[model samples]
Target chain A: MLIALLWYLGAVIFTWALGLFLLWRIEKSGVKRWGATGRLFTYK
Target chain B: MQWYIGAMALYAAFLIWTNVKSLKMAESASDFTAGGHRMGLLLGTGTTTATWVSVASVLGIPAFLYSDGAAAIIGWMAGWIFGGALIPIVGYKIRRPANPARTFPEFVRMRYDMFARRSFLQALIGVVMFIGYLFLVNIQATGFGIVFSSITGVDYKVAIFGFLIFIVITNVGGFWSVATTDTLNAAVIAIGCIAAAVTVLLSTGGLGNILDTLAVTTAPINEGGPALDPGVLLTPTGSFGSAALLSIFISNSLGTPSSPHWVARMLAPMNVKVAVLQIMANVVVLLVIWLPLIVMGLGAKALIPSLPEGVATDYVIPLLLQEHTPVLVAALTLVAICAAAVSTGNSMLLTCSTSLYYDVYLNLFGRTVSDRALKNWLRFIVFVVAVIAVVLAIDPLWFLAMGFTYVYGGFGATFSLTVFLGLYWKRMNRAGAYASIIVGFVAFIIATAADVPVPFVVAVSASAVACLIAVYATKPPPLESYEPFFEAEISESTKVAVERVLKLNPAQQSEAVEVRSV
Candidate 1:
């Protein structure tokens, strides 16, 4: 139970951090037509 | 029966409000379908989250958790987070100026070619999605019967009929109505789930006490190890195992983009930025709502030694809510559960109805259907489909989770590949598009019909492989024919959407448009 709980916590934190990091990079890359930051949210 | 009838009345009132509100706002076909692109941030977030969670998450996830333990919760969350991460990259990217298509079918036709192949692909997707969801659809109906019979003194048939009437009423409002109600439903689901989870967790003491009790009560049923082992719930890779998690993430992330029902909601977003933000917001909301149910399930196993045979596990949450919680909380929780079911049901009915009216009736027949006429047609279609679903719900044999997996998974694999490739790769032509659809549909059927070993994996994998092979085998469309479809950059509204959401300045945002034409 202890080992599985630790692993679950680690997986979640790492995945979220990784996703946010990718999001930051994608924002910086300006790969799409929108500006680096412009790609993040829908600014209606 | 009282609880069941109470749920029905509440749902019916919600439907009347939604339909009356929508009728006042709807002025054109676009308004009926996309709510005139004015849906706000909260509504967008709430509806998207609520609609996607469905009975699959509400019932299936908890049921699995009760049987398996905490590990199941981890596995389920892993799928949601991965799917959440993937959506912004693809779903948002596709909504730009170069291709502002409202529906998934339109995207396929534009990105690929508008011919026999794309049409066939769309029809195949429609059929599979409808059939795939039938299992859950029926289960939910059966659930209604069970809940009603247990709560009220009345017969089961009344509960079923009441549910059907509720389905028809909300469904009549089309996309506009569904979107509004979905937002309300999301709130209800979140509150209901949290309430149930908290009640169950407290009733059984803390997590430590629950585990302590489980330790003695649960012994290894077999040499296979502890029957109560929490490890079974956690897939390898810390969360759920990679393949299972990946299957979930890929299937859902891709599926939402290509789903006619979901993208139709996107069209109603006040702007592009709202759509992207809503997807992110949905991630948070889903976690909050689903996590508690998992905890409740695990707690249930510790408290109740064994699950009763022949009882559908999906009702476990409701059972706990009714058994353990105060009367008022139980009532609201029932509202929440019904909210979860009705929100998705409304969306499904609306999507199927719109497809019948716009894509099949008008487009195929080439009839110049008026907007008012189309709305009426959509209402009629909803009524017919609801009646059919109600009838199917009466049958006990319907398997909701597996059925949804085969049907929805197939659609996601086939259409997503076509949409992504067609948009980015100009080499894809009409012939290739047709080939991809034919191969995908046939492969899906073949994989599922024979109960071919590992149907989900086989069907999804087959469709994916067929798309690539078929594309490579076919000739490209003429360059001249494809050129008009390619715009140099995305639309201003779409760019504004990207810029605002991504928090980009005007000059920095221009970089995103660099590859628009290419």
Candidate 2:
């Protein structure tokens, strides 16, 4: 049970962290393609 | 009844308010069709993720897992991963077209440079997309009816009608409203699914207990057949057999890129880089959101080993929430389920409307309707499509996931080769495109009608072969015809030379043009 809990926790954390990192990189690069603003919240 | 009404009322009010704001921003046809191509990565990611995680993912997938086991994950989720990997290739390449198409059918027309203003191919693609959206909308309505009836004891008919009205109203603002509402829906879904998963895991004695229970629970193969080992449910080929599993994988993975709703999301991203990121992020979001539902489904199997005789496996998650979770959590979960339906339904409706207005009415028929008139036509189409979907959804023909799989296979087989080769293979011509679409669609239909065991595989293979043969046998179109795709591939020196020559006086430029023509 503990192992299962640990595994689930590990997977969730890893995915969230990876997603955040990608979001951050996109923001820092400030490179817009097509029309992308690199912003996560705003459409423009 | 009061709770259901109150929840629905609040949801409707929020949607209407948001959509009105979006409508103000959507003054032009471009804004209505493609969110003005201003969708940042965040908004794009949110909308795309929400669109992908339809009611099927929220409910149907879990139901499948509860009845079948972990193998359902491979059948459903594996295809998504494969599809996600292919998205960047096609999405990035197609994003920067010389003349950007508002809809996929329009893209097809522009890419192929078809002869007739209303080419047969454009009309066929539009009709297929409309039917596909119709099926998707029906799925959402069916899901809404089931959830509402189960929660509030409302008649399925009333619930579906209420949902239809709300969906159509929200979509009145077109792509703007859909994208904004989708972002909100994505957030709600993520939170709701995660919360449900945590509650189920903690309450149901964790993942280990669930797996152990599932290991021993035997399910009957048929009404009179012997009980099969439930352990097989954990395998890639569950009791459904290997052939069915392979078909599910092929249909889900390959057919995804062809889905007009998903393709619409791809078209909204601000840039190629953002488009690629959005695709990657979608995979991650799917993993995050799906894992919880998977655990919940497996937990339900352990907790409720024997459901009421008439109750379907699809109801497992909702029943689990009602039976085990607190009132607030259960209500929120139900809302999330509805949100999933709404987000997907609205996106599908918008795509269908765009295809009809742009591909069929304007381009194919060569209508010169004013922008305002076109917008009104789109809204009217949305209402008509919603009504049709509601009528069909009153008696859904197939199980949610399975129905989706059939449509997905057809679309994937039809468009996969065309989109792939159209972007990458310069030699691919109009004949190849036509052959691929026609042969692929027909092959899928025949295989399905004939009840071929692995119809998707057969359909995709046959379509690919036809496409390749057609491409090789026919002469390639003129270099100018390929310019939109290959221009980006031009060498820097060649580009500079061309620019330098164009900078010359008209006489010199004319001479250069004559030489090039020669």
After best superposition, candidate 2 residue B184: deviation in angstroms? 0.2
Clashes per model (N, Cα, C within 3 A): 32, 6
RMSD per prediction, one decimal? 7.6, 7.6
Measured against the true two-chain complex, the DockQ scores of the candidates, in the order shown, are 0.26, 0.13
Quote the RMSD, in angstroms, for model 2. Answer: 7.6
TM-scores of chain A across the candidates, in order, are: 0.63, 0.66
Full-model lDDT for every candidate: 0.58, 0.72
Clashing pairs in 2: A33-B271, A34-B270, A34-B271, A35-B270, A35-B271, A36-B270
In the range B11-70, model 2's lDDT, one tens digit per residue, is 778888888888886666666777755567777888888988887888988888777777
Chain B TM-score of candidate number 2: 0.91
For candidate 2, the docking band is incorrect
TM-scores for all candidates: the values are: 0.80, 0.86
Say which candidate scores most in lDDT. Answer: 2
